[model samples]
Target: MDILMGEPEQSLEKEIEADLTIGDLTVHEDRNEVMHFLHPVVYMTNIKGLYKKDDVLETKWTSYITIFRSNVYLSIFGVSVLVSILFVVIARSANRLHRGLDESALVVWLDASWFTLAALAKQGVDYHSQGLSGRFIVVSWWIFAIIMSTAYGANLISQLSVHKEQKPFHNLAELIRSEDYSFGLIEPSITSMIFQNTKSGSVKQAWSVLRERAKTNPEVLDANPANHFKMVDSGKYCYLGSNYYLEAYQGKDCTLKMMDSPVSWQHLAFGMPKGSPLIDEFERTLFILNQIGFVADRRKKWFKTRDPEECRSSASVKPVNFADIQIAFYLLATGTLFSIMSLLSEIVIASTKKR
Candidate 1:
């Protein structure tokens, strides 16, 4: 058997049709009409998006608060304020009935607010409610605090333990919708052909976008797959291609990632002349190899990394660094600075009164 390097212009299907060479090509309905394909060598393989890892946004300092929805934060805030107001009303009424409590209304309000906040933080306050109504409200607030704090703690730990990275686009539709990314696949390839021929959907829309872009920038529909990969490495482009090819490229460049969602699924098989007699024989051989685990071994050897643990160490959980929770320290610093300013202001006011 002679091996020949296929070209974009002279595709493997054309060569096989001319009885020159049998080549492995993605089995498509159009190609199936002209060439005979052996039983699919690769099944359910898909086209995935490839992009640079640097393009993904890293976990921000505000991730602790941002992980919860806006509604959740609003609900917590609303409940805390409501509880503080209730506590203040009940405590003031009790103090009025029994003149032993000398705290002013403003002091009571501040203490109530602080108590509610401290309970939410799972901390204790020195002040306690004297009346039964006030004590009942305190117990209810404690229960609410326990539930909210437990949920917050669980969610925060789960989110922070895994370093969150947000990709620019999750799937092809998002990639198409995004104005920031320019995506292209190799021209004359099965994936590009599918995108071009599809009737209506994101695939067709993507093709239209590429076609329009190609009118000005010819690289948008280039025949060379290397150009697409190079564009992807620059962090401004996305490349849509076969999963197998993308995975092979990813193995070489750790910075490159294949999106989990696939764009399309296609069967991969060897192409032969329309009336090829070896299809049956090849199918039998493939079946036998599959049963003997030969095919599985070869696939693992080529497509998978030798040491997956080493390749994925960057994604694994490690001890939390200062950078992960620096927002808390920032809040503390801001509070201390405000307290110093308040003290200075009070000192100035007292000296002015004495003068």
Candidate 2:
């Protein structure tokens, strides 16, 4: 089979009867449709995404400090404080019912705080409520503790275990909206023409930006076929082109990845003349080629080797390193030092008073 490359519209201009063609032929508004399927318009970005072979979808790793700042912990703290204050107030008001429990106001407050802390930690405390109001508060606190603990546990497990993919852009829509990477298509290309004349709002928006960039920096809008892949490799630009070309360009570079979704869908099929007798035979052969792994073999030959081990599942439980909690330990040390100094000062003052 002889392979010829020409624009789909050119098929109408040139009256050569052919059996098949290879390219994504777009259907114009006049109901003219291209009859073969090959590849789609895939967006490219230099942003790397992390993924595990076991995971169906990729996710991003979040910092522990970020997890601590979540709404769940904030709600737990707020509710615990309110409940603690109520317990203290009720304990003092019904003081006669509880005999020889606590002597000072500070002791009562300390007990109240400790009670909430123990409940929040899901640990059982030795102390029990003496009065009816105190018992009701205790029961309510336990219920709150149970719900909050379960939720926090589930959230924490998901946060720490799930593998996250870190990519610059997730979809075509995001690529257009993002300011991090500059993107465009080659001039006089079919892709550029599609965006230039599209009625879709997003396409128009992207085209406007490209047009502006072209006015200032024409290099950004250059249509050189080779420059698209080169710019992507340099990590400064995002190139919009056929996934077929992109796949070839990727070769052995693991650093490059196509966007998960594409901006548009294109059909690739063998070009044939109108009412060609071999159209049915060619279509069947195409399907057979795909089923027999011919397409897979070709792809493997051109692209990088797909290795499961490269992005395999990792340990869910990460050991807490010193850097993870250094801030917390520093604060604790500061507090302990201040308390020791305060105790020493109090002892010295008492000695002076006695003298």
- Please, what are the lDDT tens digits per residue for candidate 1 over residues 296-351? 78767756643455456345333343344445334433543453454445446646
RMSD of each: 12.1, 13.3
Best by lDDT: 1
Best model per TM-score: 1
- Cα-based lDDT for every prediction: 0.69, 0.58
> lDDT, candidate 2, residue 291?
76
Q: Write candidate 2's Cα lDDT for 1-355 as tens digits.
A: 6555766555555854345554544443331343343332112222221211121344445544444445445655665676676666666655633353445667778998998898867999865655555665676566666655554566567666765555667665677777767786778766777677788787788889888988888866786967766667666477877666665566445566666766665443345555666767766776677678776675466434445354344545443344443453344335334534544454466468669
The Cα error of candidate 2 at residue 101, in Å, is 6.3
Count of residue pairs whose backbone atoms collide, per candidate: 0, 9
- Lowest summed lDDT over 10 consecutive residues: which window, candidate 2? 46-55
**In model 1, how many backbone clashes occur?**
0
